[model samples]
Target: MIKNIIFDFGDVFINLDKQATYKELAKLGVTEVSEEMMQVYYRYEMGLITTKEFIDFYHKKFNIAKKDLINAWNAILLNFPLHRLEFLKELEKSSKYRLFLLSNTNELHISWIQNDWGNNLYQEFKNCFEQFYLSHEINLRKPNENIYEFVLGENNLLASETIFIDDTKENTDIAKNMGIHVWNINPETEDVVNLLNRKEFL
Candidate 1:
């Protein structure tokens, strides 16, 4: 029996356009995304670089203003439906399964979410989880063995009793390797609420 559930925020809870940032940058005349930029993004997600530094690096490299670059970087964030929020809230009411949120996100993305959703919505969304873990905030990220270990150890959760749901195959693969059950959801064809409902979780 799954006693704990971990969800990935980006696509599982809130919608995100996986390629929106890159597409937006291309529209802004950043015709090429360099290998260095990819490294920077990785470092940023790992919490190894500051938000200001990340923005500055992109701004200088792309010759774009900081504000515009910020917009491009945040373009991946999309709307969070009220239905999803309500679903999670309902799930939380059960108290049978411990709930956690784990996302590979950075400062700019978080700031954009706050600005877009406002404090109340953001708080309500966050309140649905027992623990909310952001990659940048925690200095660790998914698809990394240590990060998964960190969550399990920190929360005293049993891997066998936990189910991790993520849109990324890599993330789910890593969690499965650690003995955690996983749902590798495909956003294009699946609705998280529906999936859970099918599992009789709702």
Candidate 2:
């Protein structure tokens, strides 16, 4: 019996273009995403680097303006539709499972979401979850075993009774290794609402 549900925010609920930001940056002459650039992004997601520092690192390295870089970085966050919001709200009404949100997100991304969705929409989204965990905010990220452990320990949730849903195979695999049930959903093909209705889960 799955008594808890952990959802990945980016594609599971809110839409994100994983390659859009990189494509935009490439247009600005950042033709390749180097390992060092990836490390910078990881550090930023871990909350070890400030937003200004992140922007400055790229700006100084690429000689791009702050605003232009910020726009490029934030291009991945597109929009949140009411249907998804309503689906979550309905899911919450069931009260059969404790819901949590876990996302590998950084400060700039979150700021963009807040601004784009506005406070009311954001609040409605938050209201659907028992706990909302962002990588930068918590200093932990998915695909890392420790993050799943942290959530389980912090919430006193049983691994066997929890279902973790994420778009990334790596994250889902990690959770499965820890005895948590997982749904490695493909947003392009699978519908989450239908997954929830499957007889196995219910």
Candidate 3:
């Protein structure tokens, strides 16, 4: 019996073009995602560095405009469907299980969401979750055992009685290995609104 649910924000609620940022960067002369660049990105996601420092590294390295870099970085974000908000609101109102959000997101992505979704709607979505953990805010990211352990320990949640839903296999695999139920959803074919009807719950 699942007593708690942890959901990923991107693709689960708000739609995302996962490759859009990379594609945008390519157009800006960042033709390759080097290992160093990836490491810097991970560090930025963990909030280990300031946003300016992150942007500046690329600015000084690539000589790209700061505004262009920010735009490309935020290209992954997309619209959040109103129906999903309604679904989440219903889920929250039901009070059937403790709900949480754990997302691997940075400041730029969040700013884009706030601007695109508006403050009111974003607040409503956030209020639905008992604990909303963003990677940049928490300095802990998914697919990391300690991060999952942190959530479980902090909330006193039983791993066996929790379900973790994410769009990425890497994240879900770690959760599943630790006794938590997982749904590695395919956003292209699946929707979060059908959570109740998913065979995992049934």
Task: Give the TM-scores of the predictions, in the order they appear.
Answer: 0.95, 0.97, 0.98
Model 1 misplaced stretches (Cα beyond 4 Å): 198-202
**lDDT value for candidate 2?**
0.90
Q: Write the per-residue lDDT of candidate 1 for residues 108-189, one digit (tens) a residue.
A: 8898899999999999999989899999989998898999999999999999989899999999999999999889999888
User: Predictions ranked by lDDT, top down?
Assistant: 3, 2, 1
Candidate numbers sorted by TM-score from highest down: 3, 2, 1
Per-model clash counts, in order, read 0, 0, 0
lDDT of 3 by residue, 1-202 (tens): 8889999999999999999999999999999889999999999999999899999999999999999999999999888888988998999999998999999999988988999888998899999999999999999998999999999999999999899999999999999999999999999999999998976678
Give the backbone clash total of model 3.
0
Residue pairs with clashing backbones, model 1: none
Clashing pairs in 3: none
Cα lDDT, model 1, residue 128: 88
RMSD of 2: 1.0
Model 2's TM-score against the true structure: 0.97
